[model samples]
Target: MVKAKQINVNNLPISILDINEDDYFCLTHMTKNQQEGSKIIEKWLTNKNTIEFLGVWEQLNNPNFNSHEFGGIMSEAGTNRFYLSVKQWVERTKAMGITARTGKYGGTYAHKDIAFNFGLYISPLFNLLLIKEFQRLKEIENNQYGLEWNVKRILSKANYHIQTDAINNYIIPTLNYSQKKEWIYADEADLLNIVLFGCTAKQWRDANPERSLNGENIRDIASINELTILSNIESLNSTLIKNNVDKKNRFKILLETVQEQRRTLDNIDFIKSMK
Candidate 1:
């Protein structure tokens, strides 16, 4: 089933349908201000010029368009008896650019291309306003999308900083002479990785071959709760390290911090709302 959306054009509410990511505006909604809107669409369909434009559009976009039947249709155009409905056009030509819909957003809906032609047939002034309103709606959608993307990027950066700070202060300074020579400085991240994930980085990689191959690690797949818990324990672990805490003692304290933060964060109404 297709979902219906609405956009107002000059105080006129136009119904739009989303089909395969393309937008189709309801001609019925466009006619709401008119004395007879359905008749207007029927009149537009009977014109020889409208048929030619639709035929060309179908040829370019629809491989399934029936040229043989379209030839018969163009031949009969502009005759006194020549009349068409959105339904008949699709059935005869196998066109995907326009559709006859039913239920909620129900009515004759045409792609923006054909709908613009109808707008011209209606009046140049009305068509201009229609196009302007659609453009405005598009701009608003783009702005909203960009805003959400920035918010997510901020969160990812915050998590990155928290993890790195913990490793630098708490884990790096404690590296032994032989350990420093054997392991790279970056390996310190695994100090917190083991506390939260219950596995070292190498162990997690070996256990999940598919994810490791895809360039994903255990931390990359962590739940929001785990990341939040990880962020909270970073400062706590750093403080413990300053006091000369041993590895075993730090692990016990960090483990308790993870559980306590998860319990507290999971119950917050606003945080739950975000999830």
Candidate 2:
């Protein structure tokens, strides 16, 4: 029940119905002005070819897809006396995805992957037009997301330096431990920094070796994404240290968290580019 957004394509505002959190497809209806288009889609949806296409897509993408349910839908498709709406198909087949609802701006939509197949049913030219529009929309969305990401990266960098300085001044001096012990703790901090920034403190230092001895290195010059991840890692590590959690386990958790964030950002970027 995710609220869907509408996208304008060639002056026509098309609703993007969500197939999942990250994926969507288009829909239109069969009113007098659009009956031709609607009939084309209906013909496609109820056809044996369409049923096969849907079945194959479900099998490939849906782990919980009910084959028996889909079989029932397929069995009833394409009879003059048997009319099937999108809701019926979805409910009957227990489909993970479907286009539903109609009347007054309601039309047929399918998952983007499914829509592409429907496009072919309309006409090669229509399919090409839809693909081009979608690609353009994706590009716009990606650019926006990328810009947002860059901004986030910048903020993260600034915050990281602030946090690091606090650690250096307030936390580091409080330890009565020897230099070796201090260095060991510093090394642990550096490990988390490296995981986020792709460089150990020493490596960063060496890379910018020409800088003044007191100058900040690469870790201090992190992008917003790295800094954001680093901040979370720092907080989590602080708690883990307090809880006497093993460094190895903490590192694993940190890496996994970073990986998940990266994937989410990447998906957003991907979706935006498709715009």
Candidate 3:
């Protein structure tokens, strides 16, 4: 599954494609703010330095690369009459550094190194933003797979379902003992919401109308650390409910817990140390 991930640079959306476990960033997407996107790709492809770099990269990484054919291409490179497309370069050098595709994720895509070089050639400022955004995305990706990361995120979501089930069986029964007491359920849910998020879910939606309109609530964008704390509070809330801890007392304790966790997690110096 080769999905496209987008990052914005200079307000232009650049797409990165993953094909065969390697990243291929779209050169076409990178030049939406510039004139002659394809021509710019062609200019980069024909440069003597770019050609040599591509050849060297192929030599180091691509086992089946044809060096004799690459030598022929090098002799012709840098001449005004010389021309190369990604397909031609790949075909000539037996290179895997770039690809040319022609569908939704189409256009010239290059290896990360080549993409960075092309990004710099476009604009150094854009290149800086590109790297920053790319690294941010890569970090997000890592968060989904690592064991410690999975344990925390999964614990939060899993415990939430458990709490909801307990509420359905126990808490809702006292509210008229009704089968369809939906607001009763909502009210209890918001008890935890107010404790952790400092607002009811409705208040969060109202405050963030743009995010709400897009169907994303406060929980959807919580930090990993916040989610970990939320997971902790869920366990405590579950125990408190079973023991019949009054809502007023629960709120005070939970609010204190939220503040303590925030002080620890939100400190800039502490976050830098983790990195």
Candidate 4:
């Protein structure tokens, strides 16, 4: 799947496409503010060194690349009549390193390796700036992912301790059978699931066989907002459990809490950043 993202390079928003986990930078957007940006790309394409570099990249990365056509283009490169367009290069050599996209993100995009080479044609300073900005963008994304992972871990720990402490302290002692006592934790977890997700874990699994086959649970696919509401309610439910509230009354309070917190968090866009 191809995903489109953008980054600011030298104050210009350049389009980047994520194709099969590789980032392809938009060469057209790189020089969009310059005079005759198209001509600049054309000049870069006609360079013999650029041609050789692109050919070698295609040979290395593209299994179905048309080496015969690439050799012909390479021979004619840097000659007076030699000219190449992004479309021509892609079609002739079956190149996967560059692409001409259409629609909203339409542009001539190149793989990062080829993009850095093309960046030199823009300017040494501009190229350096582009590299720096790209690195910064990647760092931000990595940090965000790491933070979310940590939040999930902390939520899991909090939920486990709060709910099990309540169960072991209050509910477990009343059950006569050991098997019934063992089920207390799962039953308590399902209470939270029913409140936030409108279904029990078992019900969710039954409804989604493929996901169940892949070892995913309802909570595994939950949005950030849903998880936050779940965390809030688990703590609330723990308090209710400790206070000796009956199951029916505790369910009502937890449901209300879930609804109220969801309404509050949904309105705040930052808190609703879904995975």
Q: Which model scores highest in TM-score?
A: 1
Those runs of model 4 whose alpha carbons end farther than 4 Å from true positions after fitting are 166-275
- Lowest summed lDDT window (length 10), candidate 3: 266-275
Candidate 3 lDDT score relative to the true structure: 0.80
Question: What are the lDDT figures for the candidates, one per model?
Answer: 0.76, 0.65, 0.80, 0.85
> What lDDT score goes with residue 150 in model 4?
59
The lDDT, on a scale of 0 to 1, for candidate 1 is: 0.76
Please give me the total number of clashing residue pairs in predicted model 2. Answer: 15
Please provide the root mean square deviation of candidate 2 (C-alpha atoms, Å): 9.2
Sorted by TM-score, highest first, which candidate order results? 1, 4, 2, 3
How many clashes in each structure? 0, 15, 0, 0
lDDT string, candidate 3, 185-232, tens digits: 677668778877778889999889999999987777666677778888
Best of the candidates, lDDT:
4
Cα lDDT of model 4 by residue, 215-254, tens digit: 9888888876787777777888888899999999999998
**Candidate 1: which stretches are off by over 4 Å?**
169-275
After superposition, the stretches of candidate 2 with alpha carbons farther than 4 Å from their true spots are 29-37, 69-83, 102-108, 167-275
Per-residue lDDT of model 1, residues 173-213, tens digit only = 66645456325334545667877888888999899999999
For model 2 the local lDDT of residue 62 reads: 80
Residue 5 miss distance in model 4 (angstroms): 2.7
| lDDT (tens digit, per residue) of candidate 2 on 60-117 | 8788778997777777766777665666667766666566655543555677888778
* Candidate 1, residue 103: how far the Cα is off, in Å: 1.2
TM per candidate comes to 0.65, 0.58, 0.54, 0.63
- Residue 189 miss distance in model 1 (angstroms): 10
Evaluate candidate 3 by giving its C-alpha RMSD to the native, one decimal. 16.0
